[model samples]
Target chain A: MNKIFEVPLYAYERSSDQDAATAVRHKVIVIGAGPVGLATAIDLAQQGVEVVVLDDNDKVSFGSRAICFSQRTLDIADRLGAGSPMVDKGVQWNVGKVFFDNRQVYEFNLQPDTGYANPAFINLQQYYFENALVDRVRQLQAAGAPIEIRGRNKVEAIGTHDSHVVLEVETPEGPYNVEADWLIACDGANSPTRRMLGLDFDGRVFEDNFLIADVVMEADFPTERWFWFDPPFNRGQSALLHKQPDNVWRIDLQLGWDIDKEREKRPENVIPRLKAMLGEDVDFDLEWVSIYTFQCRRMERFRHGRVLFAGDSAHQVSPFGAMGANSGIQDADNLCWKLKLVLDGKAPEILLDSYSRERVQAADANIAKSSRSTDFITPKSQISRLLRDAVLDLSEHFEFARPLVNSGRLSTPCTYQDSSLSSADALNGPDITRPGSACPDAPLGDEFLLPKLAGKFTLLTIDAGAPERIEEGGVEATRLALSVKDDLTLELKRRYLGDATGAVYLIRPDQHVAARRDTFEENAFRQAIRRATGKE
Target chain B: MADLILTPNLDSADDFYAGLLAAHDGLDKSASDALNARLVLVLANHIGDADVLTQAVKAAALRGS
Candidate 1:
């Protein structure tokens, strides 16, 4: 709010050592200060890893880009120390209504089960989210965390080797050379790092472009995600309206492939579309407008020797589901712990391989889901459109067809079903908090299950004497005993343990299930650690 | 890989088969075959797994042979 639409230059003292031979080597250098990179830096710094972030741009993103922050992402942000402020500044929303032509076809509340601290979703401007992250990073830095965020420090060239990766950075001062033991390329969709290494995304490239306009108005619009397929306002085209934090509303109009980009983006053209969507009587001032065409694609491999990719650097998706940023945040969460352990020499470097493996799977899941939403929203074929309309018609009366009606199946955490880290357990458990799924957030005695389990290998025991925390082989584990007598523990048992009287659950640092056991077996804890880290 | 067709896939297999048989009871062989063809295509598209669908087609082609 302090600076409205003013893109200012960032001032960073030049640290470019002209001598290439004496360039300072960093432990981890993360490119891009967007949510994904900042999340990675924060996670690594929280774990005591010396991490530095390099962003080409100095100012916060101007537009209200990536407004829908999912609950899973908010949980991750909470761990990063920016969750509370984000919730305070964001417009919390959960319900979404999908309209077909002029009639409402489907409506859904992302969260029907409540009691979790964070809401199902929050509509926060990307700028505020980034600022909160920056503030958190500053606080951590002040508290002796070795995290450096260098804005206006643009990466010029990259060199990857077996031992280390070299990054040539450019600043207002001049171009300089630096190297890192590990370089995280979060440089976004047009990733210079990915291009430098000669990589390409392999997936669907969408044809249609979308015109996104953020309008500021005092009009009363319910805090619900309103999506339209062949909306009345813009005939035969899809439109979406979302309410943001500052009376600014985001309206995304689907511009067909044939439309001129220049003409479509003009305020004259956009305002008419807005007046149609929202009657001409409403007064509003245009805040920001941009055009975007997205592809549902990802790099086949997120990890390349000493270099790694996260966020838009690794994958890009259609915005219908808001999966891009959330999945990228998950990538950072999934990567940081593995990177930390490997950097500490606690886990085999193969552990880093799992980062690419798990994240690629997550990326594919996002791409698949997002692509389907895009297809359903903008049917590519006559048959597809007919089928979409049929589904819309059926969804009005039939409950079964509602799930099939896809207007962006809003992002949910990708459960790694085939993850190597997830232990192969024969014993059955409740599907709610099973292996490979993120630990379901339950209202624990005081806090929640996720916050209690994160940052360490936790052994959640039910109605059993918990094992002593065995810190061996560079592994640290804590065991928490839960009794069925306590209400919260009973709920935990119902969700996690099911009918098992005495059970042991091995949870990873990222709160992903590693292993579950009915009987406490000797060496199971350490073995789970070994399997999780891919050392076994 | 798709999940191999397991037990209890449908709540009432008997009722569904009864309805299927009734639907084709009065139809000619050509019309019944056409119906079967449409059914196969629709179910195949819903399954969406090419490998499993191919295996299924192979399995169906070899049934009772």
Candidate 2:
């Protein structure tokens, strides 16, 4: 195996001159051209790894799926080099309104810049986001990485042997076989790749179905997202409306549990629901209306040997906190860097399993968090409904009760505290370990939120002596001298330095703090470097 | 070929399709039927697919009938 650093962007194919059939075998074959697959491909291409991405669709489609891009996702995107454009295009929403009994019960102002770079959340069209990614993918393809986007090509069969995974693809022209060292599946919830591998996607399916509509409003509606319970117009149903780019409005109606399969075919059934939420006088043009069932399930495992899973392929989280695609993109971010190291022969096979372990744990935690959020939003039981209503009632007077009504916790990233990959020593320390605590998006010197620490490994330490020690041991590390303050939180001073104790923290490319040590004692730094880079 | 005039008053014309709009706006069946006949005629003019247009008028008139 070649040294990872020496691996050229298009190692197998000299240039992008050869037809895909005659093209050389790539280092990685990524299935599905969604945000996760594209993001993983972009990250791998940036690292100079030869990649080929394949999808069934000929062109990107406009859909109302995964609109809310959280600050964490923006931070991850920033590392991939498209954060600024996304931020510029998206509407930054920090406040949300929840209405109970047709009245404003709770208003939430999210604590921005508290964790990771970027804001609370931003709303953008998924199709536009896909276009941006497609452009990036095209750029990488032009650079001679052999990113053959076999649009209208479907993978018929994927067979894994000792060396590489063989993909049998049926393209418009003909059937072709392509083999690669690794395969990453970002093919969404109904992933054929996951099924081909015989991995189990087990969990409860929510009985409730939702009708999502994208409408063009003529009237001036509020920019904030509004959630209403037992809306006056529609009893036993909830209405949610969000403003998107352009004059487009995203309205979701919580249709009852049982839905006729042919309900959407009759547009009249869905149209009235939209009118009830928006006043009858308001003139609007319907862009698209579709009925979708919410499901909360995750794969038992994220990988089968060389074949791996990311996004909805791995887990299907109900869109309660917009966790489905956000978590999926994060999964791609986490898996890409590790796969690069392994393919480059920089890391052992054991490191690959950590992706499965850590991310599966993250997915499990995400599933639970999203499920809890779904239950909170649309509780099934009578007692749970009463408890939910009680919170809305109490939030009127209680200051802290607003968070319950607003529920900002849904959007927060789930940490990997009780995962096998996490070191026990790191959890017990003098300094607060944000192991699962998302890397804060605290503002740096200017208005720049601390730059996303993606693409490469990062070392953040309170010990002023650590960088010197790391350099002494032939290991690269960054030392930030932090002053321990009164609050048990990371403090960004007038300077660039942070606030904390004498502990060393190693952050992964996806911005997950992998390993933290109070003192780098007895080859701990080397072990940590191996743990982070998977070289050990 | 003459200049295809696309000019049409969409505002008041919108009220002619009030039943369809009202149905989407979460209105009851009675008010939904009152404007059904006008809704069918207005929508049939807008629909591009002939088969779909036939279905639209038939369904709307059946609801009113």
Candidate 3:
């Protein structure tokens, strides 16, 4: 039985003229109001781009889906101005414990290198995240920014062209024809937009079914990820327990592919399973019960002319490592800035092509990582099972084998190492700020490095030539000559400049390193900026 | 007894990864499996941490049978 999540109905006013033969032209129309779509909308609006989001549902996410928000996701969210609220409400956890057959094998801490802003991961319910993003979008709208989110607005049909994309949106009033300069599809795994366009979404599907249940209880479970392979509670299968906000504990039990999903989801079956794990004396109420068979698949290309696909619409993976939503959010972050640039006509339209290229590569990477996690969690073959056990066994003591332990690899942002936009770096420097990687954050006086470099094309330099005349695309280059006496300053030097005294780095608006050179010549720097913006 | 440093210890990580993958190239599933088994044994012998290896095997051993 599926219980509907109650959300305040948003009374949306229709913008398109039904009487007029032609539709109103919007700068961008984003389909689906899930994390990805909403993130895209919020990002575009932050860039002063007029954007609208359409979704079939009036409420936020039903269950506590995607509870583990990665540090990178939070960093991206904070950049979008929604990070503080989530961090405020979220359960910050970095330590994780992996078990095999009811015995603790090893404990690992993600993002051990400290002095940065955020933790490794935060466990917040998906609903809170969606609500926060929606609130931020509403705030931007109230501030007279061109952003509209229409709940109960569903995309029925989609047509793409070289010039623009057309959409038939079905609302409560009726069907309305609308057109957009570019259409972004974030309509989730079963994206009707992708189906309507007749594009193939190809990937591997695992045979195991995981029973995901969230139960509200006041328990003393520590804020850490607990993963068990063939636990006593669920024999011959794996189980995962994670702490979420509002005292809800997320329990995932591997149910095997042959189990009756309907019977498995019933309160009769679910309560016993929980009781078996948590003991019979404990009391709890089930918040959500769902079964998922994992699949790692994606479209060949995220873009088809003017229509762009993002989030689950573009690629989907097993929810083991919290990769699905995190990658989707990154997809939105990566696309929105580039889309804003192309829309503003500041750069060539080919910049949009890089969005698909980089993100498709990201999707493939996520799929590979997540699929391996899934295979480890639920071993299908005898050899796979044997290998998994061997790795887990060796992981308990040997630090070398510890890396083999895969409890969903945990979501991390993909660095576009092979990105076409990256400039050839002939300079001697550390690989930390390599072209096509997100610029590593370090303390700058009172604030962090990312916040300064974001929202502009920054030519970052540390202990390099004294930048007297700088200013290329939008902002001037930063010359950080802070003495390495400070630990943070030293870390910055080790990461960016390395053993060298100084290195000049070209950074994109998204804070990805576009190029790095020992000395920034005027012509070379200009050419690098142009290439970064898809002018090459 | 020294507390094992849990930080990055390897240099040339990218090259090592490429070599690792390249070593298994052109091999089918079973061959790759055999190779991984041989590699693990070789590495385990190289490590020679009996207590750690024992703890690891014991940790992943099948239970609740």
Candidate 4:
């Protein structure tokens, strides 16, 4: 085991709130100090919103879980001030190879073109990711941000009121009561908070089990994602190998439905399997071993009155596509800005409803893609297996069949195409930057485009005329003017202005395009800001 | 999108039928099923247009019923 997990980073320290005679009411209380919870708190605190985070544990997670982080996630982390450390400690890879029965079928490059600031994906241990986030929280605290993280403070009961939520928390001292104007539950999949509220997820539970083994070894395998289907070593099942930082390799092997999970996880049974895959001469030590059965499900709604759910507490999917944690981080990204507006009374409370609507749409998309991948990887019926194997076999010979072979589709950022907040798109710009799409990164001399749009409504003007700032219904959108003549790389023109000579884009604080037009008009831009902030 | 060819398009219909039957002559139930799946996939790829495939699938389902 790693030494990082042994030492408590945020040890149990008594807080003044625990000793207060009456239940202390906080502006916002976030449950579970995992990645999503920490991100929510950090985003809120950075915007000067007071938030309190409570967790049942004090240290990072025990194992290298959720090792694959997508570029969109890195972009969000960059805005939160934790991107540099994570990127520094992560293994970046863009190439992935698919193998069938000991022969490589085809390889893919995730990042074919590179003018962006981040790579397509980075492999970092979940513990390191969490530690980076917690470190960011500490930095914010030192800078006098109104955020507090309490360890060993677990909420056991929850009561939803008309205007606030009351929670009965259990700590080392005893049980005490706390109140919050709003509650955000980032507790994990088996969320006690969700259960206390009598909520459940509605979707399919796959009938296959997977064994995840993290081993420390020095090997010569290239830093790329390698997935095998029905290999000789693991006959009739699938296996995935990925490189992580610190010489830790993540290996996932598919185990059929009816097996003793405990026996399969034993080192005695695991070492032989490793020896078969990596020849008998290779020496390695098992760092962590676990078995997981996955489901593609989510809550009916993420927000219920004043209580909200984020991360694994609201949705879950199989680990095949790395969608679980990536989508959860996006949940934090979609939520914090709207929550900030609601708390500050700049926008109507119904604006938070769009968070649930949009994220639930995103969750459904993740679930659909994940479910299809699971079906392709683990065929349920004889006919389905025959078709799947046929695809794999033909892929080795035919170019068209290669696309039919499904290892895992991997994850991409979700675009809120039908979001109510998005105004009519009239720019005829690149589809990648249309209304409701996450703004793709482009080069602007030494800086990138996403960082310039960080955490505020900005009017991104390209060879167009716009005011320095536009205020609508108490929401402000500042201008970020650019010209194609200054873009030596032409990436901004290619990504933002496909055929139009000039473009103006209204970008939300979450870095999603709210509206775009060929040219700026004051009345239209002002109405777009109002629509995006839920004032309309 | 073109409609599925319901008319006689095969140059030698009997010959094609004979060849398909010969392909599955000695195979058992499972092997024959596997072979049929591969053949279907091959033909589907050959007729790559999605609209034509949907029409053919609907026609085949109606015939089966």
**Candidate 4: residue pairs that collide:** none
Candidate by candidate, in order, the iRMS in Å equals 7.2, 20.3, 4.8, 1.1
Whole-model Cα lDDT of every candidate shown, in order: 0.82, 0.67, 0.80, 0.89
TM-score of 1: 0.87
What TM-score would you give candidate 4 relative to the actual structure?
A: 0.94
Estimate, for each residue in A1-536, the C-alpha lDDT of model 2 and write its tens digit. 53221222221222232346552466888888888988888888888888877777655544556688887788877777777777788886656778776778767766565533466678887765776677677776787764556566688898887778888877656667777888889898889998787778887655467778888886887788888877776566677888888778898777777767476536687677677777787789887777777577787778788888998888886666777778877887778877877776666776777778778877777777766666667767765666566666656656644555533244556576654444445534533345545566544434343463555556665533555335312335554444334223444322223332466666666666667766555367567666565454
Assess each model's interface with DockQ, reporting 2 decimals per model: 0.07, 0.01, 0.06, 0.55
TM per candidate comes to 0.87, 0.78, 0.86, 0.94
Cα lDDT for residue A92, candidate 2: 67
Poorest 10 consecutive residues by lDDT, candidate 1 chain A: A2-11
Model 3 chain A: which ten-residue window has the lowest total lDDT?
A: A475-484
**Per-residue C-alpha lDDT of model 4 across residues A381-432, encoded as one tens digit per residue:** 8878999988877776777787787777678888888889999888988999
Once fitted onto the true fold, the runs of candidate 3 whose alpha carbons sit more than 4 angstroms away are A1-5, A14-21, A108-112, A205-207, A397-400, A466-489, B1-42, B45-65
Ranking by DockQ: 4, 1, 3, 2
Please give the C-alpha DockQ score of model 1.
Answer: 0.07
* Candidate with better DockQ, 1 vs 3: 1
Query: How displaced is residue A278 in candidate 3, in Å?
Result: 1.9
Give RMSD to native, each candidate.
Answer: 5.6, 17.9, 8.9, 2.3
Candidate 2 residues lying further than 4 Å off, grouped into runs, are: A1-24, A108-117, A142-146, A205-207, A406-409, A424-433, A447-452, A467-490, A493-503, A518-522, A533-536, B1-65
Q: What is the Cα-based lDDT of residue A339 in candidate 1? A: 89
